[model samples]
Target: MKAKWRIVFLKEFRETMRDKRSLGLLLLFTLMYPVMLGVILNQQIKRATKPEREGIELAVIGAAQAPNLMVQLKQKNISVEQKGPMDEDAITQLLRSRKVVAVLRISDKFAENYQAMRPARVELWFDSAADNGARQRDIEEVLHAYNSSIASARLLAHGVSPATVAPLQLQRYDTGTTAARSAGLIGSILGFLFFPAFICGLSAAVDSTAGERERRSLEVLMSQPARTWELVTGKWLAAGALAVIGITLELFLAHAILSWLPLEEIGMSWRVTTFDLVMVCLASVPLSLFASAVQIAVAMNAKSFKEAQSMLSFVVMLPMIPGIAVSMLELKTALWMYAVPMLSNQTLLREIAKGEAIGALPFVLTFFSAMLPALAAVAFATWRMKSERYVLAV
Candidate 1:
């Protein structure tokens, strides 16, 4: 009803700019993503470069009577413990009880069988159905190694060289350039790191505008000489500004930590070239606009600041749905991926982080698509602001 809304918006914009909480959130948003990504990058780097260790826990009973076999198993990193020879029943129940990952029962006749050149069956008991296939593979490999060593010894007894029995060998050749392999995958994790910072701006925009309305302070604001659009626009831009700060920090942080992590070790570059940063910011515009619109609209519906806070908190949480859904579906950057709002960014951004060329078309389409929802929210919110119930504070 009054031009006071413009004055009110300016006041809020200035007030928010000065407030430490507002400043801190923007700073934290920018830093938070990089921090999160850095932790993951560290973990991945650790995983990729870390020396391999045996995962299966093997308990070898009757190891004393089969000391040769026991020594062979230890060389393969299998954990062996000597015990009285286990009967069939003891071995059976251990697997059922899950007392050990695998039970190695050296048959009581093992020494006799090997000396007689009879096939000695060392029983390995575990539930193949219940355990992971990888574990089974590990167990098989350990046993195979022992068998091969034993076979070589038997061959020596037969007056043959161990090498002569199996002279031929296989070697692996890798054709994948490190960059190609790294670029193919690391972006999604980066995307997860980067997305939530913008959520802070969205939350601020929603709480400040819609929240102000719900608080009845909007009446105080309406008493000044400001246009309704000015109020919305200033706050919207401020929200955008907050979004800009957050995203900029994320990029800088992403760059800073990228150099230290396995991302580079894997041959992917997260360095934000001038062009890359510019494109990232440009892509962020639609995201910020849409996010701001969401918060403002939701906050406007609230009747108190507390109510607005609660609602916007939930709004902050809404992005997780898309984040989780995209990850679970394992959808890559398809044509339709660009059509979805947060998800499109999530997909393409991974490419962006790894210094890959994501087309401008998807970025443009995603921004425009997101604007639809933002506009709808803005329209609904603006209308509510103009209502007798809101304006009259009835």
Candidate 2:
């Protein structure tokens, strides 16, 4: 009986492998991930790693009052190109056309207040879109250093020791390993990290069998004397295998690029481990099954392939909905979070990235949570496959 089941499973696997789309998507998973992510990460790194330079078209709309500040900016290598008296609209246009990095509009009282030793107001206009922020931050840092230097110089000029201006030094103590820091940053930026394996398997799984169901070939297979569950499991495993292959390749590609590429030029850096990848693949198992089972069940009820495909695109893309939040929100994942199918997988993968031991409780609950949905979907799909109307209905 067992041998017969194996025969059926292998047959299902071999049959699905024949379709070009199934084969391509399977291979694509293996190849695409590493290539795509490597490119993106390398670009990010390059942006971040650009050499620092000191030249920006700054339009100063105030009087030549802050000679001290101008001297300070000049000392920092910033070229102070004062654009003679201009209104807000003119300055706005200058910024829009990239005429200047920042337009400093002084409230005519700037000089008077400087003499009175009072803080004066200044409007700095910038086309933040083009600024890229990094340069602006450097400019700001230079200005801050200038400000501190002047303040300390004045204290000494007033007969106060420079030490009188200094209070206490603040230092950061990072007790964790390098991996933990890298994981925290990576988790925030690459929220889509853990999804490829599950999604790749999901599409192939649904298409191989459920797709065939809608195409009427599945009925041909069902009409044959093959055991039902054996046939289904065989198909499921085939899709799963393809998914695993694709995901592995993608992981390799992703790591190669992220680890090797010039990422600092693009304002990014990343690191991932073999262990992190294994956990991702491990977590992907249930999701792929659930995705396949849900689609199979849905397609089982559909009268046509088009209907099934239309309805199931949502199911196929279900794992991607929370993508923005996953990447941007930086929320902490607790043990109870493992109860959520996709979320748990991400949490465990993140832990594995940090070389932290995932507690057994979260492990069981997460997979079990995913298991519930998968079993229900499989049960419904199995029962539907057994029905004569379901098998042959128009």
Candidate 3:
């Protein structure tokens, strides 16, 4: 029986490899994912490392009214362009031009109000629609520092301690590390990394089952002496093997790209080592098998290649629902997450990227989560194929 299945497996595997379209798809997904990921991450790193003041161009009107404020702004590395007094319309045009981050207008009564110990009016004009949030925040910080200095000086002049206004001095300390903060973003990225396992063998699975039936060869194969389980197992392994190869190569290439790039620049880290990646690939092997088994079981029921492809396409996306729902809910990881197939694999990789030392249980759960279902799918397909109805249809 084992020999019969092995012969069937080899035959199907050889036939799948002979199909250029299937092989081309396998290669495309294997290379496309890592290249795209690297490009996106490289762009992010470049953007994050750019100089903070590179775009902080501020236009200040009524510079004479607050000469000291102008000096303070310049000291904070802000590039201030002095402008003559203008109306709100003119200021709006200047901001709309996008040449400057923001405009600062000092009222004409500013100097008089300051000398009289009254609150001076300073209007900050900004385009809220513009992508100058960082620059605008920097300008606001400088203005805040200038105002606080003036208030402290006024309090001292009145012979009162400035500290009297601040009974509570609270200092903020952020305990979140860069890696910890980036875990969520990286988790989303890694969630799609395993998707190729389903995609890589989709064409092969559809063609082997529905395509053969459409071509009238499935009846011939069924007439052979091999039992239903042997034929079904052979086809399942053939498609699953393609998925395995595609996913393994993809993981290795992605690991190389991630390890070479400086993810730390964007407050992210790919802390997975070579050994860890190999172990991950090993654990993920059953995912490919599960995907292929499910595809074969569904596609075998279709009357034509197009119908099978359409049906399995929807089935392919079902695994991603759990991952998406988990992300949307912002749920913390629990032991049960390890039993949820695709979600478990995603969670495992995410925890590994965060440099966590998750022990052997996740690996065990991840393996069996897919393996058991895969065996069940193959069994069902075998039984379905043996049915009198299926025999008559073929």
Candidate 4:
């Protein structure tokens, strides 16, 4: 004897496949989502790898008065555009136009002050609101180093050690690894990859539950010998199967794109191997199932196709909240993160990307966290279907 759920499952699955709109959406997301991710990351890589010394221009109001400063700026790859003496308004307008990063003004008393061994004032004019903070800092660093070099020379000429004036020395050591640097960026990207699981099966779930009821066909299907649980499980499985296939393909395509791109240039990498990828896909199966189960449970309550679609749209967005919260708070990966469905998948992928030895615990937690909720939703949907009010409405 055949299982009644299998009969319904096969029927719904075939119908979903025959639905051009559903299939089209499935195909579109499977191809486009990953390609979009690849394009975004590729742009980041290009930006990161671009030469920093290019495109930095500085305008000097009194260039001839500071020949030594010009040489220093030139050595730091800063192009000096010599300008005649300009008043404050002219310098402010030049900065507002953004043709140069900053304007360097040497006071007329600079040479006299230096000759008398007094303070020589040089002014740096910049627009703080501009997106040139890094460039501005680089220029300021060059000026600071130039000042130190001159101070050291003057002390040496006076038979005094340059170190005599310097009581303490400070140095910076960066202990951050490439993976550490990339964690936030790659983690954010991974969060979005699992969203297709919610989207791919939306049409099928809505159609089988709310769409069927609106067409008056669900009443006939319910009259069959199969129990409510069987019917609900069948529709749930059908929707889940589509989601599974879509998310799995999307992940594989994304993996290929990530592997092909030189993410190392941006200090990021998709370090997951084919074996690791297969494992991740396997673990993610329950996430698709959970999404489909929730869709089926909620969409089944709606009175019409449009109602279900609108309601399910909100349900789809629910999964994104956890992932977005983790990102906004910049939370570190913890075992508890594996208890959340969409967030679990995201955390799992990020851990895999780190190329670290994460044992089976995460995968197990990720799988069951989604699986348990899926089964519960299916149960609730079955209970709802069995209610007298539901049958009366149908």
Candidate 5:
């Protein structure tokens, strides 16, 4: 003989499985995040592996005035296009169009200014909001080098050492490793991978509770011999089971995509091994349960499916707030982070991705953080269902 909750679990699970629309939503959420992550990372890898200055195009308003500058730009593999003198408005439109990395406008007085040993006025125009900072910096470096060379020549001709005007020579050495630099980027991605847990279970959770109520079937179920806790537990488990499957598949797919990509080229890595991933999946199980439990508790209060969905839409996004806040503030990883459900899973995965051998405390904290909340939600839902007002309203 099966327990009442087990019977209810099987029944709700089968009904949820039978809804093609529910299954379709589950599949979509499960695949969408991993695919998005893969595509984004792939683009980064492509950009990183591309040759520097391979296809930089620069527009010069007066190319004839600075033949030496043009030669230097060409030598650096930058293709320079000559254009007639343009006003600031024209240059701004050109930059907005993004046809060139930047525009170098040489003043008509450049030749006279150079001959008279006055500072030449050259303007570098670009869209600061555009993603061409690196290319713009390259062009600026060439201009700086040309200026230095001419300065050195003038000093030599005047019987003065070029070093006389210089007091310090500076060089930079970066101590941060590739993995360290890429951690924030990878962490942001990992944070969203857990999003499917909330989405995949949402329809099923809402349908099994609020949908049933809207159809007036919930009253009949409530009147059954089964206790309120049993019914709530069964529904919670069914929704949670779907969430678990969705998140697990998403994580594995993400792992496959990240592992196959040449992340090393971009100073990023997915250092989680098979064993580490298995542990991560295990620790994340409670997060899915927590999502389902919270959804069930919240959805049961709504008078109809539409209302429940509108409310849970906001609820689903609530978990991401903490993670985003932490990222925005650039907070350091600490043990307390693992005590916050969604953030815990994100931090744990980030640590593992950085090849850290974190001990069992994070896993324990992650598990219990969500697990306890889940149990409390289930309890609250059961108590809510058993209330006189709830029964009368139904």
Candidate 6:
């Protein structure tokens, strides 16, 4: 019986390989997905490491009123562009152009107020719509420092202590690292990597089942000495074998790309070594089998190639739902997540990428989650194929 199934398996596999279109699709996805992911990640790293601002450009109106302040701004690496006094409309236009981070307008009574030892005013003009918050904050810091210096000098000249103005001192500490910040993004990226299992062998699965039936050859094949289970198992393995090859190659290519790139530039890390990746690929083998089993079971029920293709399109999207829902809910990982097939694989890979020492339970659960359902699907397909309705239709 094993020999019979092996013969059937080899026969189906040979026929699938003979179809150049199916071979091309399998090869394309195996290469395309990893390359595309690598390109996207590279772009993200570049953007994250790029400098926020080369220099904070500030527009100063009535610059002569506060030459000392202008000198202080320049000392802080702020570039100042002098302009005559302008109305609100002109200031708005200047900010919209993004040529300056902000406008510093010295009040007309600035010099008088300074000499009189009275309060002075300055209007800070900026466009809230622009992405200049960091540059604007830098400008504000320089202005505050200048004001504090002036206040201290004036207080000392008046025989008063400048320390009385500030009763409290505060310091800020940030505990978040780039790796921590990048974990969520990296998790999302890894979630999509396993999706090829559902796509790579779709054409082969549909063609072997519905295409065979539509071509009126299924009835003749069923008349052979092999039992229904043997025939179903052989076809299932053939399709699953293609999915396995495609997914395995894809994972290896993605591993190479990730390891070669400097993911640290964006606070992300790919700590998976070659041996770890090999283990992941081994654990993921059942996912392709499960995907193919489900596809063969569903597609065999369709009457034609186009019909099978259409129905399986919706079926292919089913695996992605769990991953998307988990992301939307922002749920933390738990033991139960490892029992959910596609989600389990995604979570396992994500945790592994984080360099966590998750013990063997996740690997066991991930393997069986797909394996159990795959066996059930193949059994169901075999039972369905033995029915009088399917036989009559064939």
Best-matching candidate per TM-score: 3
Model 2, residue 335: C-alpha shift (Å)? 2.0
lDDT of 6 at 31: 92
Poorly placed runs, candidate 5 (over 4 Å):
41-54, 58-71, 80-117, 120-133, 156-164, 214-216, 219-227, 260-267, 303-307, 387-389, 392-394
Over 1-394, each residue of candidate 1 has an lDDT whose tens digit, in order, gives 5445445556666777777876776677667767877797687665544324434567787676578776776776656655566777887777777655678777778888878889986877777655445555666786788788778988898899998856788899987655446655664465655465447576567556656656667677666566566667667666766666666667667766765565655355555466666676677667777777777777776766677778777776676577677777876557777777777666656666555566678678767767777678667767776776765545
User: TM-score of model 4 relative to the true fold?
Assistant: 0.87
lDDT of 3: 0.87
Give residue 143's lDDT in candidate 4 (0 to 100): 97
Q: Higher lDDT: candidate 2 or 6?
A: 6
In model 4, the runs with Cα more than 4 Å from the true position are: 1-4, 25-53, 96-98, 128-130, 224-227, 260-262, 328-330
Q: What is the lDDT of residue 373 in candidate 1?
A: 72
When 1 and 6 are scored with lDDT, the better candidate is 6
Q: Which scores greater on TM-score, model 3 or model 4?
A: 3
List the candidate 6 regions with Cα displacement exceeding 4 Å. Answer: 22-36, 52-58, 64-77, 84-105, 111-177
Candidate 4's displacement at residue 32, Å, is 5.5
| Stretch of 10 with least lDDT, candidate 6 | 45-54
TM-score of each: 0.67, 0.72, 0.91, 0.87, 0.81, 0.82
Clashes of each: 12, 21, 0, 0, 0, 0
Candidates 1 and 6 compared: the better one by TM-score is: 6
- Native-to-model Cα distance after best TM-score fit, residue 10 in candidate 1, in Å: 5.7
1-394: candidate 2 lDDT, tens digit per residue? 5665567557656766667785776566556655676666655554554324436556777638677777776676666787688877888788888766777676788788756767666676777788446655655776678567767777787899888756877899968666676667666544455555456655555565556766778777777777777676666565556555665566556666667765444433454566656656666667656656666677677777677677777766676655455556756766666787777766766676676777667667766767789778777777777878766664
Per residue, candidate 6 scores C-alpha lDDT tens digits across 176-243 of 55444555677887777888899887887887788888787888889899899998999999999988
Supply the TM-score for candidate 6. 0.82
Candidate 5 lDDT over 1-394, as tens digits, reads 9999999999999998999976987798789888988898888777665437357889998888878889999999999999997988999999999898899999999999998989999998989998776778888899999999999999999999999999788899987666656666788768888988898888888988888877878889988899989999999999999989998999999989988988888776677788988999999999999999999999878767898999999999999998999999989998899999999999999888777678999999999999999999999999888876664555
User: By TM-score, highest first, what's the ranking?
Assistant: 3, 4, 6, 5, 2, 1
Please give the range of 10 consecutive residues that has the lowest summed lDDT in model 5.
45-54
Q: Model 3, 1-394: lDDT tens per residue?
A: 4588888899999998898876987798789989999999997776665436274688999989999999899888888899997999999999999888899999999999999999999999999998666667888998898999999999999999999999999999987766556666778878888998899878878877888887878889989999999999899998899999998898889889988999887777776889988888999999999999999999878767898899998999999999999999999999898898899889988887777788999999999999999999999999888876654554
- For model 2, the superposed segments whose C-alpha errors exceed 4 Å read 21-43, 51-126, 160-182, 188-191, 197-216, 262-271, 317-331, 359-376
TM-score of 2: 0.72
Quote the lDDT for 119 in model 2: 69
